[model samples]
Target: MKRSFVALMAFTLLIAIIGFSAHLVVLEINDTHGHAWPYGNYGGFAAIATIVNQVRSEAQANGWDFLFLHAGDVNTGVPESDMLYARPDILALDMMGLNAMTIGNHEFDHPWSVLSRQMAWADFPFLSANIVYKGTDKTVGQPYLIENFPDLKVAILGLTTKTTEYIGNPEYVKGYDFLSPDEVAQKYVPMLQKMVGPDGIVIALTHLGIFGYSEQTVAGTPGAVETAEKLDPPNNPYGGSVSLAQSVSGIAAIFDGHSHTAVTSPFNVNGTLIVQAGSYSKYIARLDLIVENGHVATYTYKLITVSKDIKPNEAIQDLLTAYQIVGSGKLNEPIGYSKVNFANEKDSTRKADTLIGHLITDAVAWKFKDMGVQAVLMNGGGIRAPIPAGTITYKTVLTVLPFGNTVVILKIKGSDLLKAIQWGGVYHPEDTGARLNEWGLTYTVTPNGVENILLDGKPIDPDAIYTVATNDYMANGGDNYSMLKNAQQYNTGYVLADVVKEYIEHISPIESYPFTPRWTEVK
Candidate 1:
């Protein structure tokens, strides 16, 4: 009887220790794309900070520890952040106590020299195991970091998308090689596990776009499912070509960005959990992980929208207000004024027609008309927002074209242009570029219908090689238009934002027109 009682007592002790184990609370926000302020009632860093603080306090009260992380892409959106070279956003994040972050493609939007300087201001460690230094195999940041808890050690690692080679400025990424995520995991996981002594938990922060696949080609056209797939580690001894949650072993939770889609519930893939907060500070994702007796027992995730109703923390609001006040003073200076009004109206949450798309594409085409350019195909996916009605400023120009893309003229056969257009259209039909910027190009976009693209009332001859003016993004085959890379590029030496700014200033106030379907419906 005493033997049985002692055994039962031991079991009870185990349960009590497990219940008292320290729990972890992970908060994630990604794809700010430089949206540091509230745009159209949706996002702002101050509001996000408020929500995070509230949740952190509540979670702490519940015996949980908090770690704030940003998946990547902290640069290039609103005028305030981009105008100062994303300084305000980085400073703001530092004030909020960002724990760790993954290096996103946009981080190299500026010159590498500039990025190197900016890294000094970051409060958290920039993590990317796949990005190797130029001419060396060294990783960009420390591969992994282990945080000690009362009952467990948590190791965090980072991975950047291989697509960064094509998306980022090749000049900045020179001499550097971005290894495959799957390969990196296979090598590093074992090393980290050994170092953690087999009792630690692993987490991966990834910026490899989202899971949803868009089947379209570049040049704003549509066709078969002939497009580049989203980056995922391949199926192997490490894992499958699925989400980071599925591929990397030992990753208990994943924070993802790049595609900008938010997954609130834990996307279960082979028993791993994935969570992503929507982009631009619109949502803060919280993951409550319960570790019992040296193992993860449960993971609860929630997506908290930073709506206006939530009272902004006073301290955060004051900091934001001070920054904006200074930013407004500098940004409000009139470089040029608009004589018309432009608006990007939407039905529900899907993209629709926009006058800004038309004007910007027109400006780009016009800038290179003297160079024998036949047509220009500007990807609608690149257009971030519409120029607001009323006065336009230098800041407005930056917001409209935040990516710092340069203009390049590509020499391509007319046939390839048509093929490219068809691909982009079929995949992202709602996009303005796929819809042919309706205002400038003459084309008919119908599902499975004869793909026809006309320039200046004439069908392009298939055999003719034409000079095409486009941003460097398309020149590098971004948005699944790989064929353009072979096309000889003639640099126009024109800053994309400058050209658009000149056009907007000359066009005066943007005139709002009735919203109409940009693509024709054919039977």
Candidate 2:
């Protein structure tokens, strides 16, 4: 009897060991841009859903776990998604069982109150450990959340970029402070790890751009490479998750977004795996974690394009269709028609006179005319795309200028205006070799071949006063245009898109292309 009992116990132990060898597959998407339907043969909500379902089914068959995550910035690309207030896209995400997401700066491009309201609708928690709430020490979001799958304990912490000025209304983030990623890790990881113990897996879900360090510029060039490499592992006595993943104690991965760039492969910071699923829902990232003894023993990462191989989920398509039915009424209305053919050339510096640019600048000057604004200087880079002549609708406006950038009227001395012009001339190192967009105003290139000062064909004096119309972006020195930072600012609540809409209403549709070059070459 004793011999039989020993043999039975050994058999049970062997079975348990096999059962515990379960693996986890984490799939994530970022910067969907409200594309519920795939563009070309690539992704849409339906096609992505098909991929998710397949991954889940296979994982289940193998006794593995599956999870879905997003890095935010879901709305504002297409007319259907933007006009419907992002409901269709959010509904689709909920159906896909998205566990958690970080709030991107674009999320606040609407209004502060609207952002709070939208957060209420999310099925999964919206997280951000770094954004501070105004007038209090508390953070602006759920700092961290743990998603438990059977025996697996997965912790996801959310973070936004520290540079808030580039994305939204600075006042929107006013009263709220932002903590650095390192600071956040130092503060929270210790306490969380003590509670969850060593078996828990921690991931930082960030909208802080694709590059890992501060020096990782948008163009994928090394920005802070040497500095990042020399930084020591985060000193957390409790063995917390704080490293940049390379040397961070317990962190397993980092999923990043915001640069609108794609990382085709997983980036290894130290020994940690970092992945981003490009923007516009163009791709999905798949990461597999093999856990043993309550820790990640091994891992693998792959990026899957949301292409034709997978079938889109029908349910998501139906939801989008229902929303589109409503949006079609408002978005598809032909506010005005354009008779001229407008094209946005990739290599053009004179972005002036394109139908969309003209319509936008005209709107700006018109909106702020009541506030003593005489001229407008719209940045060419801000003009994302041209107005395709065939059908100009509400949706068209949103895609053309996605950032809900408000127009600000500036009261500045003539010298200040000259400085602004000079700043634009040398904004980037590549400026001299390439021509950037110029509009309305013309300047003379000095014998030095530098952009010298001029306005209305005369040399600009620094102390003379001028009324200028520009967007809040330039006012805050975005894109390295720092000269406008000191100009007296006047708030014009009128949105650039709304201004365009009014211009369209006033002009109606033209029968022939009426636009001509407004840019003047330096004589």
lDDT top scorer: 1
Clashes (backbone N, CA, C under 3 Å), per candidate, total 25, 17
lDDT of 1: 0.68
For all candidates in order, the CA lDDT equals: 0.68, 0.66
- TM-scores of the candidates in the order shown: 0.81, 0.80
lDDT of 2 by residue, 30-138 (tens): 8787778667677588888888989999999987888888887876677677665677888788888888888876676566776776677778888888788755668
Cα lDDT of model 1 by residue, 370-392, tens digit: 88766666666567666655677
lDDT of 2: 0.66
Q: Identify the runs in model 1 with alpha carbons over 4 angstroms from their true place.
A: 1-20, 55-63, 213-242, 309-315, 334-354, 410-441, 444-450, 462-465, 509-523
How far does residue 123 in candidate 2 sit from its true spot (Å)?
1.1
